[model samples]
Target: MSRYETRLEDYRRRERPSYRVFEGMQELVCSVGQLHNNWLYVNVDQWDQDPVHTPIYYLDEHWLEECAEDGTAATNEQDEYIPLWISDRQVQTWFELATFESVVEVLKAAGKPVTLQMVIVAVKYYDKRDAYLDYDEVKAVTDLWFVLTKVRNHLTE
Candidate 1:
């Protein structure tokens, strides 16, 4: 069987009920681009094996601990940039959920210029760590801030 076929069969067999928005939806996943319009993808095997696909964590270390309480975890190492893979649908949700206050708050929390590139990176990587973010405290602003932290971490500056 083809890998896709095998994975589909596996999905059928798992028999668990969860709202994994991107579960088995590999095609919708792509690298968090430097700009909102940008994107990248590769063979699933490459994503599984390549260190380059890891997120450049941009949050303060303490918030990672905070996020752990909310069930998101992350791993990364300094390397050439390719960007962490995330779900486009989840990103769209972030923007749809966004309010003007949310956007301003996220940008302020970033504690820098919060340029267009940074906002793009935040959107693309918003769902990198989980199938969906489950915590009530995680507003659009908070989620954006989390990924922005990843963007900041990844930037060489």
Candidate 2:
């Protein structure tokens, strides 16, 4: 194959990312030093090189869709790069990356709509439901959820 054809073949055969990539990705994108670590966390080969900036355009969006609690596809069309494309398992493996502040930043960065309700959902789903947080962490989520619910009700009513 010619050089261009070889590159095209490689791109067509791209593999799905592994769990470790999601783990590293969440850690890298978390609040600690996140501003400078927005690049892709790891290569498929799991190397420890500098951050790579490969957009997942080659991946199937359906394969990447977020699922409901019962495992059905959550179909409102998340429409943001991270929320729409990351797998449910990836979200479960994610930690600090799903906080309300980080979520706001993600939405804003993607130029997607950000709403208080959506923030509440992100906290509930990613932090409370998906992550394996401890008692104190769960309590923190409860507190945040309580306050956010009150605020949303007050604003909407």
Candidate 3:
């Protein structure tokens, strides 16, 4: 049997009642149905006959501790207990560039004029970690101040 078939068979034999799966920003309460390459087939909707194949990397741990601490837990449309799946990438983008003052200071030290567009572009560039950040393609603002601080510290050392 192929690797996919082997994994699917193994999943079938497992006695676990439920599995928590994530797809990008959404969390899914599911049961393992099959495993193909880097994806795991999950049955998300009991009424639906088809299962969704999600990337294995998106599998997340349950939120038992978080629920206990907060006294609240996430649930699906069916009111089934589920954990919230917050995207690492989204968190990195959202609150990463909260402070622009520090970034302005770094730019001043580098002899670069502090302009609104320049700061915006710089934030985008740092967020992507890409060699080239096209003006039209900048999707998120990253924490450039954090990166600049690290680079400055390294140079001084």
Candidate 4:
């Protein structure tokens, strides 16, 4: 069987119920553009499906504490850059789950600027781990920030 088929079969056998809810959904769909540069342009609005996605959890360094049981956790200078599309989603999701005040706090907690690129990187490589964020995962986090920002900005204006 092909890699995709194998993965599908393995996924079917897994017992994790949470992952199952978003099973079989496409992660990303690409749109072709006739740009001069060799780059792919993805439209966040063109996602496969719309659902309630959020980043209700914090990126605590404790989750991977076990890996450093014998000593302090190893650190690395692994910087990541998330595509602009995912960043917008993060802002959207944040807008939905919290009020303008709360959203601003979360953004502050996450650090300043709150740029689209930074949000995308958070989703793609949040807390310097969990590289494989599936579509639904991305959607939830994006939705939270996306909605929150709108509300936050409106309140300010």
lDDT of each: 0.35, 0.38, 0.36, 0.33
TM-score of each: 0.20, 0.22, 0.23, 0.25
Q: Using lDDT as the measure, what is the rank order of every candidate, best first?
A: 2, 3, 1, 4
lDDT tens per residue, model 4, 1-157: 9999986775566332111111111211011111111211122243213312322211122322443464433432222122322334332121111122222234445343444333443434432363434334444677787899999999999
C-alpha RMSD for every candidate: 18.5, 17.1, 17.9, 18.2
Best candidate per lDDT, number?
A: 2
Q: What is the lDDT of residue 99 in candidate 2?
A: 45
**Model 1 worst lDDT run, 10 consecutive residues:** 31-40
Better of 1 and 2 by lDDT: 2
| Deviating ranges (above 4 Å) for candidate 3 | 1-68, 72-103, 111-113, 130-157
Better of 2 and 4 by lDDT: 2
Clash number for every model?
4, 0, 0, 24
- Ordered list by TM-score, greatest first: 4, 3, 2, 1
- The per-residue C-alpha lDDT of model 1 at residue 90 equals 18
Model 2 lDDT tens row, 1-157? 8999986675556443321232333333333322221223113222212222321112223333533333543332233233334433222222232243454454445454444444434444544455333334444666787899999999999
Point out the higher-scoring one by lDDT: 2 or 3. 2
Candidate 3 lDDT by residue in tens digits, 1-157: 9999996786666544233334511122232223211222223232122223322232222433456357554544444333345222121112111122233334445553344444446433543463334333332333455577789999999
